[model samples]
Target: MEKTDNIQKKIIEDVIYNAEKILEAFNNELDGVLDYSVKSLEVIDDDLLSQFHENLHDVDETMKENAIIQFGSYIFEVARRNYGGKYYWYEQLDQPILVTGQPDFEISILAFEKVKQRIENGYEDNIPFFFKGYVQKLATAKKGDKELIC
Candidate 1:
């Protein structure tokens, strides 16, 4: 039993690490766009600033998709590990919870709330294209010993 628990713990750690890496990659990509936006705002005129902001959004659009894919991949991998690999940490869902930097935290909360609201409202068609699969996977996951308050 001890050995089984250890193995399950390891699997959970691996999933959490993979998710964090995905977040790191997403953050790195956003950082570049944000840095450019900041620098541009410092010197550009109001008219150009609006355009810069628009362009920034255009450039960073892929990051949102990447973030969703990362979470989806995380869910898939966790399910794989628990079922296929015999590491049964699925019983303790708290193990793979993620922590983010303050700015990232704010953005994540806002994005999650938006998604949650859409899902609650039955606005299926309006869900963000990127998060659709991720949210679905999350919804289907079995509740475990660990609860995510957020």
Candidate 2:
């Protein structure tokens, strides 16, 4: 029992640590627009939502989809909270562009893919709540690490 408890505690710590890294990167990318304090974010549960598990036989595929949606939602929610709206517009050169434009959307897609790859290839830690690569990619994309819009 004690061993189980310790493992759970460690997993929680890892989640919090990863969350902090993600938020920091996000804030940096937006130049402090988010201003997300660590105290504002919390991990509520580790259980998968039942809606994503209707087809038990396709558990693997379902889990992948669920993870993708959840991660995407998290990204969208953070943007919304910080930007004070669900979406925003920016001008690139002389063209107006939506924040969730192709490149930005691809970031979320790639994040899901990375998580899926990690799951299939095997991960050292059983904790599936966070993927460091996904978080880094998001941070980079948001920070305009590539040709993406900030």
Candidate 3:
């Protein structure tokens, strides 16, 4: 993925690299257990959600913080591979967001926040359900339904 926009590019390079590393680690550690399919949100669940939640109190601050990026990076990769999403730095929020633009509409995902939410609230923040809903909405969206970027 070449740099597209100046704003998004600023962080996208690091994000892309981190995302790739996360995927590679998964392939090795899980022995290719987690497939980067449409329902690949579990990649995040497997990578850090399980750890962070299981050892919430025992974990160090650095691991806790890094887990967000590590898990979120995997989420971005899965979304990119499965949903045709791309990373763009959102200047206002100052973070890279995954944007999957369809002919009818766009599916923008705050992948890190999704990870953070899952780490904090567990299943109530349902990353799988979120992607499932987005897939459903994308399927139902018509060309003339209006172009929404969010």
Candidate 4:
């Protein structure tokens, strides 16, 4: 039991660390643009990250994966920081889902999966649109009002 707990704790730590690394990466080449704010995510949308993904094709496979992971982490951080949430391992999906809200309502953000789609589909898969919509829905559930979020 202790071993399992230790492993789970370490996994969560690494997941969060991946997100934190984005800030450092931004300073180097990613335009130093991540502020961990929801608005910042909107900036990275459109062809910004899609173009970045296209450029990654010239690099090693690890670099491509890093592009997905780094931005995926950034998206996860934005949702977690703005609305409050906890990451849980979805064993069936084999993904770390950051679930926000509870009892009254619940909104789960599949940060990594959405990032992959944004890279592939370009503007069609809007990350901010996905996140803000879910959060707004959750807030509406709780408050019984439709106030804009993000």
Clashes of each: 0, 0, 1, 0
> For residues 60-134, what per-residue lDDT tens digits would candidate 3 score against the true structure?
878776777776776677777776755667677566787666555666777777777777777677677777766
What would the per-residue lDDT of candidate 1 be over residues 33-149, giving only the tens digit for each residue? 212222222222222223323444463646544433344334334334332322232234323232122222211112233322332333331333323333344445443322222
Q: Please, what is the TM-score per model?
A: 0.27, 0.28, 0.76, 0.76
TM-score (C-alpha) between model 4 and the true structure: 0.76
Worst 10 residues of 2 by lDDT: 38-47
- Residue 112 lDDT in model 3? 76
The residue pairs found clashing in candidate 4 are: none
Clashes (candidate 1): 0
Best-to-worst order by lDDT is 4, 3, 2, 1
Q: Evaluate all candidate structures by whole-model CA lDDT and list the values in order.
A: 0.35, 0.36, 0.67, 0.69
State in Å the error of residue 63, model 2: 1.8
The alpha-carbon RMSD values of the candidates against the true structure, listed in the order shown, are 13.9, 17.2, 3.5, 4.6
**Model 2 alpha-carbon miss at residue 106, Å:** 14
Model 3: colliding residue pairs = 8-89
- Top candidate on lDDT is 4
Better model by TM-score: candidate 1 vs candidate 2:
2
lDDT value for model 3: 0.67
Give candidate 2 regions above 4 Å deviation: 1-59, 84-150
